[model samples]
Target: MPSMGCASAIAKIPVSKAGRKNHNRHFGHSEEILTKEEHISAMTIEHEQNTNIDDGEFDQIPQILFEGVSSLKTIGCPGTLIPVTNQTRAVICGADSNNVIAAASLLGRGRCLVFAHSGYPYMFINVDVEDRRFVENCRLWLAKGRNAQFVLIDDTQSLSDVPLDETILVWNGECIKNDTFMQNLHDYLRQGGALVCGATPWGWLQLNSGKILSDLPFFHFCDFIGIKLTENYSNCSNPMPFQLELIQFKNIHHATQKLVADPTDIESLCIVGGACKDLNVDVSGLPIDILKNIAMKAENEVIPSNSCPIQDKCCRQKSNGLCGILCVLTSTKAPGIANFPGDFSHPPVTETHVIFHIESNANEWYCTGYYAVAGIPIQIDVLECMGAMGWSIRIGCHSDHLEVCF
Candidate 1:
């Protein structure tokens, strides 16, 4: 639900042709409840209060939700405000004129050039980001749930004061205006310091479609940090970004009918599609398996696809420790529809969260892994509009790895 927390999470972004324009949409995710009743939707929502709960209420949520993330909640309704930028479609907004959340990014470095969404720091958590203070409960949750640490950098002046080796700067809306500070931060990154621009709702321009296009600025000080914004670019071609198209297998090698040559015949969730449909010979719904990367034999060339393919090519699974598929996404769309040879323990007792970050756009998707005991099926349900900044992921679960390119 975290990934698909937004109503528009699962549905694809509307993509249009030359003259026509497209719009935004929302998708929803549900939980799968296995019970004797046999006839009920999975998403179970038990709202104790109809009224909005304040910071004190956050602790009541289950511990599972904060597995790999920390959260912050604060009291007070000072509200947020910002000053509109001059000669540009930008504005500095927040709880006041000083607490600006958005900025315009000038020509610079790294990924897409545009406004940075200095909004919610982490997409996985739901909270009023205006109250930007790390909650003690959240800190404890991440440490206990994942053995991870969460440190809040309360000051930017400390940037130069501290050493920059493997440092990951999570910039909240606070603008880095001083040229000297920008240069110092940039140099630090060149030396291998990691940088991530947070999200904000400051630069929200009323679009022709009557929709608010919100993005934080990514230029000026952000340039040295490898974040820039492209001018005069305001249109979304693909709306349903997560709709997974099913790419069936076309051809299969006869060897696939038999298990791996090894005596153990280890189970593998092989990445088979295009021409490798033959390898998925488990129509009866038996366990699906593939050779691990280390188990791949020299003869395991490539299985030629039947009906060409999505990107058109032979299909092959790289057995790198593939307890699951490392969906290394290379396209704008993550593989929504995926097939895995189900060989995990019956009735997946553990619910693992797989988070993917889109490089082109700093968007993220939180995929929940569900294994149905009845069919031994593995389903990676991607929640709707969940995204944030960052590359490398901290994965915890019993499945193969998947990478997405968007």
Candidate 2:
């Protein structure tokens, strides 16, 4: 029997921590103190409210994983300061004045809960009941509604040896140079198998070679998944620099951004392959000036075109008239329509690739990808235009199969 995907069940989570000496130096303490032990105040943010399932309402995966628990008392530890990628898809459940302590990420059909330092393991050195309970909650959240049988894959074994249908692969390796593994992984995702990737392909590519190769397997993988990995890296202790503002949801027949009150509801999938709108919700149309602004941003690479046969096909489905929205295409190359900007489908589907200029380290790093939203389903991409850079929130799905990346 096929088990759930990586974040759903079996997985390997990497934890990055700073050295003790650096930790002391960072806190402005004397080098003589071997260890600095102090309780930090962690504030919790409520991203979503629980819904009553019995009332026929769609229940959302609690964005705040640490429910009822306000804060955790821990010895001031040094861990990776994880930046928030997407607000709707992830929640900073716990955070001190300076850093994020705990969070939960909801992907396609899988869920993952993350903590700062050696979370559960740290309890052995100093026990905190809240930490223990939080760890327990993380366990339940990941393992909920599934069996727990796991398989370990090392250099001795091949991914082909394991049944793709029966496993969810968690790959945290530095780089995947193997051609066969990449091909198999692509097929697995198309078949609705999920994956949890610790590092981005650009992280590997930039370190190896400064240029991106279109023929590379990693390039194909990112194209297939509708994500663009940049050669940028986040600076030390910098919080997330961008915020996504939900634009107006308009014409299901032509718009790329789709909003769902509840992502888990299967009825939303009716608009999956087809762009016809069957729902009776009011259309908060996108502003014309905003559309022109987006076009102007991509003016260098975006060529204005009105010859979309797909839009014509979708317009025939309903009585709604043709939307006169202009279309833009990126110059990036891949195998298929993944790079084309259009109203594709739902969460985890990237409609078009956003272009970014490579600059010096004076600017912060931002990567673009698709993530399933909790309260509302949408996708986020980092775009720079008119000397301003921020997150561009839109909805699109190019994949026929449902899978998620972490």
Candidate 3:
């Protein structure tokens, strides 16, 4: 059965005094340490609160095996098939049909099956026809057994109805249902199943809801994929034209590849991808490449960056007089600006002081004042560019002033 590549490591750590001390130190905590049993109990409580499922529900599910053990021959397909016995593992993803199909094909060799669903509830409600059809095809393929296992749980079925065992949950972004599913998912993993989750656009999942589910194993699960979902996606404001540049990342499981997507336009204001656990491998290769391609072919032109002049910097001194300082600065707030100036253009001004100015009408203004300065020598990259830069500068009584400056 395909085992959880990362969870095992978390479990092996001892919970004794030394282990607790190590964990506390590693996590930066000096609070009381819980014993192994205590930790499990806490996790159980947290899981239940998040998933809204009882221990009974999780225990009733059968164990799923992913690696090593093998059984049933085939699902009447060319790919290898293992018996859906108690130990048979399964990956349940809420991805588009293409990903479902591709992931299924790639994971078919494992002693597990892939269960893909059509677009999540949000997409089902808003996507256009072509997009809808694409999702339908995914559902159809799974239902027809073209892939491992295809199941659909729409508004008709309450999340509670879904059984949990050796199951993996994948969503385009994050899930907002509640703790019920999360609890059950935890139980399923404890019972032995790995969850391969990716939050595309990085923190895009959090946009669905302001809540953060980082406390759960979801954050830890991302390690296997090689990326860390950041709390910000502001870097995507001027999403590169699909064809002009394709952002690719490496993956531990697969080689790098282009991400294909509609080229006309992309949601520039959302999180895209972020830091990876493994820099050598790009896990976001497939989806990112696909999305990038789609955006390139898009009819809409790419948006510009919004530069702010609030600069921040960090400096480190090496052995000799040599020192490296990293500096970051957002351009003065401007209306209608989308993209941040490229780092190459605004290379750090060695020993130079950067200044930011802003002017805005009193009634149209958003804030009283905002200013930042950073002095550094290291190369810096403008995180994101939104659009025209503007700021309001209060000059005595005539404070209501608006000026457009980049």
Candidate 4:
């Protein structure tokens, strides 16, 4: 194993491109043949908005982080794992397996960025945290590579001390009711810094709207990010529980793969926020020419509005037994996203219209490009369930009741 001090040598470590031989081919086959105006450059991002770091020093990490025993979640999608680049070295593999729990990606100019799935609630005090590798790895990852000689943060250090650099930062955590944390994140995004929140950046926003209510009507964070909470799918049951079979995970989209170090079998993933798409970060933007020109004209239209008020407010169920603080990716605030209930824990829900379906489903519908939500695994074909067989279909962002029916 390479020592932390030898980051230069570690960056030079030879890694094999064992499994990613067909990325380009796959994208080519699935192309929608977008027009010139549709393809946004990653650098020319249009952000209507926005990190604070303190010490400006790197944290020193102990080798023990790579030595912990583990129990990994092969359950729902843990957010698509980024491709294990030929340059990636397993900083910490999970228990009894080679599944990388923490990894480092050495980019150009001797810059190194590490990703550790440990700062969140689930991984915080679990067995995976035996040596505090998880938390430290995240802090260390943000230290800005090359100059990052220290791998462990001091007792007084936190992400607050990690200086905010202009980069893509994903705040995938449980919940954030703190004002300081919110402000810190706010500052990061305000400077046109790319930030992806697939989890709990909306706790404060939701609280503003009312816990029992998911409207998330107004907030600068929501406006600047171009998104707002609409539902908490914990109550949206799959009605057809017995019929549904094995859990299925949606693969990380091609556009999002760059966000993670080695994007592979990743779950616990939610849709990318609209702000992320506008910023041209990791999210795969909507390809809705078909939906706009053809689908909408057909009467079965999916409009993108800011009014989706759900009456089946079953807030007790929770999504997959986890908090489902679902939010719409758009800034227009009405309520909910296209009448789609917040709860996917029950039946009648086909995970077909996942994050991938956002743009294709008609960006007008506030249904997705959701943030601060949990992943769901289900059976049943989407077309079959929606009863879209030879029927006029229109899906928009505003609604009062059933989203789409036969």
Each candidate's clash count = 59, 3, 96, 65
lDDT of 3 by residue, 190-234 (tens): 443333223332233234332232432333323211123333222
Say which prediction, candidate 2 or candidate 4, comes out ahead on TM-score. 2
Q: Model 1's lDDT to the true fold?
A: 0.27
Which candidate tops TM-score? 2
lDDT, candidate 1, 231-337, per-residue tens: 12122211101111110110011112323343122222242221122111121111222322323232222222233333422223323212122231111221211
Which of the predicted structures, 3 or 4, would earn the higher lDDT when compared with the native? 4
Tens digits of per-residue lDDT for model 2, 65-92: 4455444444233232222222112223
In candidate 2, position 15 carries an lDDT of 14
Please give the lDDT score at residue 110 for candidate 1. 16
lDDT of 4 by residue, 1-406 (tens): 1111211111111112212121111111222333323323211122101022211111122232322323223322121122122222233322211122233322221223322221332332232534364334433443432222221222212346654454444434333324445455444433433332333322433333212212221222332222222222111111112110111111123213432332211222222222122222223333333112211221111222225322332321211111111121221222223444444466442334332221122212232223222223222122222211111222232343336521
Ranking by lDDT: 2, 1, 4, 3
Candidate 1: residue 75 lDDT (0-100)? 18
In candidate 3, clashing pairs total 96
Give the C-alpha miss distance for residue 93 in model 4, angstroms.
Answer: 16
Estimate the TM-score of every prediction: 0.23, 0.32, 0.28, 0.27
* TM match of model 3 to true structure: 0.28
Task: Give the Cα error of residue 62 in candidate 3, in Å.
Answer: 30
Per-candidate Cα lDDT values, in order, are 0.27, 0.30, 0.25, 0.26
lDDT of 2 at 140: 44
